[model samples]
Target: MKALITGVAGFIGYHLAQRLLVEGVEVYGIDNLNDYYQVTLKKDRLAQLQDKPGFTFQFLDLCDRQGITELFQSHRFEYVVNLAAQAGVRYSIENPHAYVDSNIVGFVNLLEACRHSSIQHLVYASSSSVYGVNPKIPFAVGDNVDHPISLYAASKKANELMAYTYSHLFHLPTTGLRFFTVYGPWGRPDMAYFKFTQAIEAGTPIDVYNFGDMKRDFTYIDDIIEGIVRLLPLAPQLEDVNSLEQSTPQAPYKLYNIGNNNPVALVRFIEVIEAELGKKAQKNFLPMQPGDVPITYADVDDLMRDVGFQPTTSIEEGVARFVQWYRSYYG
Candidate 1:
């Protein structure tokens, strides 16, 4: 099978593409390679897959309508995974337009392309940030996400709505994965784990927002990739019953929370990091910033039922793996 993966140079995209290629799938990947983080790291990820026989790379922006439309026409991809978006909750406060342009506009472009091309399945990245300030523990897919604290979160919620529209009208099979705080080797530098590691190594003060009161379901990258792969083949199915019944549409639409389902406190996460690096961190405690949630936990019941998604890596094990990679890559 052939697949098109957007944001191929991204942390998750790189891992997902690698897995698909190993499974003998033809993978075409595109990324604008925006300077959201280190360009070198993104390039390094691409380098690893450059020699792989079934991998193809395209330097394209999702906002380019003509380019994306032409890409679908040329590639004839059976599946398309949309992962490219302007990421970062805090960054959204300073530049809301970036979120609108990439997350909303770019996503619509991809959806339109899918509708025109008759793709088999469309899976895209959503975020746990959509839960906003809700006090609800173990945020479920059925929960109301109408209140988004950040423009980034709002954009993701919009993506899901848009996907639902296409699924209902065009019968496009769409799946949205509301990923929690994904962390591991080759993770995004803007994430807390990555930033903390960098500061600890440089002997600089790490900014601990919410005064270290935040909590997150820190999921490992490998486990996330595993869940993605498992769900790829199992598209949603639709069944009608005289009485009310749960429906799984075969026309291709579903949403799942791919997470560890365990929320770890910010301070505890830092302690694990310090242990892994063998150094205490200098923290600058600060009040919670705008567009930031105090806690995020996932209810992966749908994911477990559908794809049997189970995360096995503990925080200590995951952070140690990241620290080891950080030293080897940067030192």
Candidate 2:
């Protein structure tokens, strides 16, 4: 079988491609390799993928409709996983168009391509940020996410709606995974965990937003990839409109919250990092920034029921693993 993975140099995408290639699947991976955080890190990821068998790397942007159309025509990929996006909540406040152009427009291009292709399944990344200040704990796949505080969250929500439309209109089979704060080895440097580790290691002060009162359903990258792997071949059949709240669209479409069902307090999360590195963080507590939410908890009951898998990695285990990789990579 063959697959096309967008943002293949990204943390989750990179791990997914590696796993599929190892399983003897031909993986065609593409990334614009934008300098969102660090181009070098993305290239480093690409370097590892390049050495693997049954893996092909391409320097392409999803916004290029001609390129994407040609790609769909040429590859005949059975599966497509779109992990590419303009990530970061705070960044979205400053640069909103990036989210619209890359996240919204680029997504439309991919969806159009999928509409025209014989694609079996298209699984794309939604986000926990879509929950957006809901007083409700344990954000579920069925919850109403109509009010998003950040453009980033809004863009992800838009993706879900657009995907539903395509699935309904064209009979396309699409799955959307609403990810929480995903972290682990080869993770994005812009993530709180990575920045916290770096600052603590450098003996500098790390900014603790909302005075460290926030909590996040921090998922390990391995766990995220495992969920996608299990859902790859299981395309949904159209269901009744009354059952829509359960994450089933009235089309060959489905959505699931693919995250750790556990939420970790930001302060406690920092403690785990400190324990791993044996260094205390000098925190500069501050008010919540714009587009910031106090907490994100995932309701993965549906995922567990359907996939028979749950994210079991503790914050302690995941942090220790990340610190080990960080020390080795930076040394």
Candidate 3:
């Protein structure tokens, strides 16, 4: 099978590409290589896949309508995975327009391309941030997500709506995966786990937001990739749509939360990092930041039932793996 993966240089994207390549799948990957985090790290991720067989890379932006259309016309992709987006909640608050251009306008261009290309299935990355102020203990796919606190969350929710519209109007098969806190080796430097590791290694104080009261469903990268691989062949069928409680009978669209059902406390997460690094962290507890949620607990019952798998990586093991990669890469 052939697949098109946007944001191929990203942490999750790179890992997904690697797994597909191992399974003898031809993968066409694209990335703008934006300096949102560190361009060097993205380049390094791409470097790993550059020499792999059945893998190709292109420097392209999702916002480029003409370029994207040309790409779709040139390659007949069976599956399209849209993981490229202007990520980060706090960054979205500072620059709302970035989210609009990438998450909204860019997404529209992708939908148009997919619709015209008649792609078999389109899987896109949705975030747990979309839950936004949801008081529910474990956020479910059927839960109401009308209130979004951050522009980032709003853009993701908008993507889900847009995908549903495409599925209903154009009969495009779409599936949205709401990812909880994903953490692992070669992960984003902007993530808390990475930052905390860097600070503790340097003997500096790590910033503990929400005064260490926050909790997150930190899912490992391997688990997330496994879930995606299993769902690729199980696209939403129009005939079986009614069986899905979260989907409409008329639309071939579905949404599922892929997360470790267990939520880890912020302090406990830091302790794992410290233990892995063999160093003590000087934590600077601070008030909750704007656009930050106190906790993110995902209810993955539907995902488990459909995929027969859910993220099961524990925080301790995941943190240790990340710390090993960080030390080896940075040393």
* Strongest candidate by lDDT: 3
Kindly list the per-residue Cα lDDT of model 1 for residues 84-172, writing each as its tens digit: 99999989999999999999999999999999996778889999988898888889887878899999999999998898778877788
What is the clash count of model 2?
0
Error of 1 at 82 (Å): 0.6
lDDT of candidate 3 over 169-255, digit per residue (tens): 888999999999899999999999999999999999999998899999999999999999998888886653432455454788888
State TM-scores per candidate.
0.96, 0.97, 0.97
TM-score of 3: 0.97
Better candidate by lDDT, 1 or 2 = 2
Backbone-clash count (model 3):
0
- Candidate 3: Cα lDDT at 3: 98
- RMSD, candidate 2, Å: 1.6
- Candidate 3 C-alpha error for residue 186, in Å: 0.5
**Candidate 2 residue-wise lDDT at 189:** 97
